[model samples]
Target: MIGVSHIVVDWGTSSFRLWALDRAGAVLAERRSAQGLAASAAEGFETVLETHLAALAIPEGVPVMMCGMVGSRAGWVEAAYVDTPAGLDRLTEKAALVPSARRPVRILPGIAQRGAQGSDVMRGEETQLLPLIREGFAGLACLPGTHSKWVRVEEGKVSGFATFMTGELFHLLRSASIVAPAVDGAATVDPRSEAFARGVGDGLAAPDMLGSELFRLRAAWLLEGAGPDAALARLSGLLLGAEFAGAARFGGRGPVALIASGPAAALYRAALAQAGVATVTTHDAEDCVRAGLHAAAVSAFRLERMSA
Candidate 1:
């Protein structure tokens, strides 16, 4: 077996993913857990990280590169932000070193956008964009998640971007709002459902009416006998459609390249299609992050030979 040479971590607010990579950047082993920044902050970042490394039997001195909330002010070490119109190369150049670690540890800095539209920032998503930058991809790219991001890239630089609270809103509505009972115990929405498509149309046509439309879901359940599945589908469609509508206003002109995986990807594709927006490309979020981390590792550790 090839000896582990570097460790890549994508640590977020609620989840953690670790990959042990050889010099060639191929994964030798992986570890994933719910021990995110919040948990790690309480348990001690060093302790959480060392325990994971010990379980993987990774040798000491293997350099570690991390991205995401792990670099936020609330994380192990604050990595600061690189302003927008930023290039991927700048991310590598500005990586912050974590002091007092047994092994070399560096955290990649995130990108920030400040303008009349207000300020916005992202942590781990910057690493995921390295592959797009390397490929010279220009246009709109959407990263769908808890807080979805719509980024506009031009000539290998992040020109501008926006964030939507779609996923978080969905969680709140489904679990804590008046619409909760309608979707309680319901299975995930089927992306192809007609109810979902209708909801998308409703959202695009009247995004300003989202609050009223949400109440309509409950009305449909209480008055018109709507099924829980249909209500769930409608809710999902409404939220995603509103997000796409907002993105359309700021995404400039071009086809969207969606970076996502699994069910979220399918749902986004369906929503976009229903909204009449063509998706020119789709990249797996996991794959992009891995490739991005590999790229960052190469740039950060230039002196190290990257061949097994």
Candidate 2:
């Protein structure tokens, strides 16, 4: 409260994280909650935002900067997408303003690929691309999540990108499809599991045979009594493998980089290794998002410089 310069937020579909920071980006205070876009939509976006603001004792005049689904068309404000082959700087310039708030609030814009052949849109993940551009990162970057995004950066701009529903598909298949019984009581997926490796091989080897491979996991449970752990790992590997299979064909200009913060880091790393991609540089997901959010804050607001 005393020395805070601005507040930065990462408001995703099911999670909310806010930080009070000085001009130098050192966090002064922090808050995290389950009041993501969905919960905030029902509870009232401003109301949800205010509750946290008040809890943090965030003073009036401290502008708030946000990224993620909070800026989605279905969230607080529709922070339109900046089409591909665009500079990352467009994110800060095109940020949408949130109206009628206690203080100035803005949400960063997402990126869109409008090509007739491979049209796609992504929100929230673009913030993760800022650091890459800032560092002169040129090549492909794989950011894994519910909807994993593989982006191509060239000449300090996002040239092209692709998205995969690997996580969502894995969840749907395990809970709602015929593969439920096979993974119902499954233990955590072992990165080094033999079944996992086999599944990865199965996917990369036969991309067109994915449906059959998924069904085979269930069949293994029925006849050979394949355990839950193996079943889950096998399924995860299959999905990730297929995702990479398609992504690999996206045409690479340089080595791959994996930006992840959680278990996804290891999972994606292992999957990449299995797919014969062994020269990836790994960056911490938190670092990239924080850098991106701060950069957006700087661009959208005239951040006050702290005194020496």
Candidate 3:
């Protein structure tokens, strides 16, 4: 146990989740709100949080730590990236703890890195990856989110990761792209056919053709006369398949841990199976974040207390 007061915040672009934990990192109270980085833009961050904290009746001066897109350029403040292959020790910053009657609040900095090919960065996912990597296999952790991350773990530390906007791209193609217009209003999806596997196979063969692959969906409808739902599943299959292939190169026959749930996990499972790679999935989203935050908080508190 670090101390009596415990607070953890996973503030992102779309939503904000706060947890009040006991010294042992057990949740006492938790709340979720729409006051994400985007929502707070108009009123500013402090106001966004004040409203939520007031409603929760949280005391002041509680030690608080945060993760997520809230640390991005569009977020309250730029926390900077800790780079890939990083560990809990790389997390730095005692962000101006929001002042309150009970405690101080601080935001942790994300991570960033640059190499010859290019530079990559992350905001909050690092927090979630921390404990997961430490708990299971310690080498090369892949986290699938809106921006799927291929993180390299060395000695139980997050060394670095690359983020591909796979999920968002899937949404855009399905909702806005011409190739996926047929699937815009889909209600259900069926991935139990050869078409699904075919898309996966094609996508893996040419991962970079994702943008152009949308044309296949449209062509399938016009030429092959495929249905809307089938087209949607095909597109989904293509994206997942490509990502799986690209990410597999990083796995290096090493164990890979997937941290996600719902339908997304299923799709990933199918793709991995098709590719003949073994993986493990943890379904609890909040639990993953909590475990991550627990590791982060423990490390930070120790470092802070040590220097003190």
lDDT of 1 at 139: 89
Off by over 4 Å in 1: 303-308
Over all chains combined, what TM-score does candidate 2 have?
0.95
Please provide TM-scores, in order, for all candidate models, with all chains considered together.
0.96, 0.95, 0.86
Between candidates 1 and 3, name the one with more favorable lDDT. 1
Name the candidate that leads on lDDT. 1
Candidate 2 C-alpha lDDT tens digits along 1-308: 68888888899999998888888788888889998777799999888888888898888878888889988878888889999887877889998898877788999988899866389878877788888788888888888999999888899998788899998999899999999999999877888888888888887777788999899989999999988899999999888878878887775323688889888888878878777785458988877887788888877786754233
Q: Best to worst by lDDT, what's the order?
A: 1, 2, 3
Tens-digit per-residue lDDT, 1-308, candidate 3:
23335568898878889887766678877888887676688888777776666676765645567788776778766666665556666674433333442444556777777786259887777777766666655666566778988777777676666787888988888877787666766765455656677788878888889777878788877887788877877787888778877776677234567666557666766666776766755445567787777666665555345323
lDDT (0 to 1) per candidate: 0.88, 0.84, 0.70
| Candidate no. 3 TM-score | 0.86
Residue pairs with colliding backbones in model 1 are none
The TM-score of candidate 1 is 0.96
Among the numbered candidates, top TM-score falls to: 1
Cα error, candidate 3, residue 89 (Å): 1.7
lDDT of 1 by residue, 195-287 (tens): 899888888788999999999999988998889999999998998888877887875224799999888999998888777788889999998
- Candidate 2 residue-pair clash tally: 0
